[model samples]
Target: ACDVFSIRAQTASPPAAATAAPAQTANAPGAPQHFGRSAGNGPAAATGLWDYFWRGLTENYFNFAGRARRKEYWGFCLFWTIALVVVVGAGLFIDDTMGDPDGSELPVVTVGLCGIFLLATALPWIGLNVRRLHDIGLTGWLFLVVFLPTIGWLIILVFALIPTQARENQWGPVPTGVGI
Candidate 1:
């Protein structure tokens, strides 16, 4: 009767192993730990948009030998555009204040400001694009395609939109924030 009771009890409920799997998986040594964050916000998450943008301008300004994931590239692009607009706006205001009473259509002050910004950012911009190409497992030399007549910018834009390669390439290991 005891044996029948035990068998019936075991059969009546779910198996012990079945219930223990989730617990084991939660405590498994090899499983990833999120602490309290959701899966997407884990430690392997990407850096902030501002961090990526500022770092590209300062820390990685001259760095061309490594890879740059998609987020880093786009972050730089977005902030660069914003900064450019701000600079131009400030220049326009200055020009307007300084009395352009001659009714000149040329925005000399704005043009000068834009030129300065362009010169200052040219190297860092190229380096970022180079690293972006490396992340895609392509040669940085391909960035020269931007010099093409009409299709150059379009090609570079296409390259920028391409996703990063999952595996590390000759440039270096997969960039941080990007998971294996």
Candidate 2:
């Protein structure tokens, strides 16, 4: 009778190993801890021009050459703004010179060229930002967060400049040998 009861109790019990797996894995030595690398090296590239600009507009992220300082971002913005203003102003000047004449091609060509140049030069920064996000252990999609304006931009800027998290968070393995 005792043997029968013991067998019944054993059969009724859940497998101890099944419940232990998750717990063991959580505490397991050498388990993968985090995702990305540290912030030592600077930006990594993604691809394409539109991707770059879109990322910048959203993320407030700007890093180049494996490490970008705040000064670099501001300086680049200033330079690009001045360049754009000059290019557009020149296009308008050409239009005025043409006196609204039909079939004048110079102004059209000038305007188109300026637009191309602006976009071309404005790209590349996007990839930089994506890499910066990686440094911070964030998804590249977070770049979109800055569209919220003052608060959103402020938040992103803070994150971009914050020393990259020591351990990886999510984006990828931490970058090596780059600082701040």
Candidate 3:
């Protein structure tokens, strides 16, 4: 008698996982289920967003050859945005406290802080974009679509909203939490 492994075991490439930025967790066949917004049950579901965000900055900073679930992509974006706001706000406060003589002067402090923050997060965001593209079964090169003048970002937004593939792909297996 032949015992059949999971569909993922048959089709997903193990080597492809090496390119993934975040550590992968395997779901037990009869794992407990938690409802609402998470893909995992219990604590796994509760921390999924934060875990996804931190992993994007640390583990996936240079990872561009794998798949990313929508939750992961959005989690990274949400934190990046909050951090940007905080940095800019601090810069503005510092500039105000310093009391610039001329109101016409350029916002050096604001620009500098925001610039550094953007530079630091740029690569991770790019890698995220590429992996996000792969998640939806698109070529990573389509990331160029994000460079298209005014409409580029809009196009990418649509891409980001798309759900993950329901099965294993060339890049890897279905992300944890999603249903097959």
Clashing pairs in 1: none
Residue-level lDDT for 13 in candidate 2: 65
lDDT of 3 at 106: 74
What TM-score does prediction 2 earn? Answer: 0.42
Candidate 1 on 2-93: residue-level lDDT in tens?
A: 69888888789777987878545554788654321132333554378888889877878788888888998998999999999999999999
Please provide, for model 2 over 1-180, each residue's C-alpha lDDT reduced to its tens digit, 9 standing for 90 to 100.
469878987889668997677544433688555423232234754433343344455443433323322333444455557667888888778777767667555678467869786677654555555556666666667767767867987877776676666654445444443452
Worst 10 residues of 1 by lDDT: 33-42
20 Cα displacement, candidate 2 (Å): 57
Candidate 1 lDDT for residue 91: 95
Superposed by TM-score, candidate 1 places the C-alpha of residue 113 at a distance from the truth, in angstroms, of 0.8
Candidate 2 at residue 114, lDDT?
Answer: 90
- For candidate 3, lDDT tens digit of each residue in 141-160? 99898879999999999999
Q: Could you tell me every candidate's TM-score relative to the true structure?
A: 0.72, 0.42, 0.72
Between candidates 1 and 3, the lDDT winner: 1
| RMSD of candidate 3 to true structure, Å | 13.0
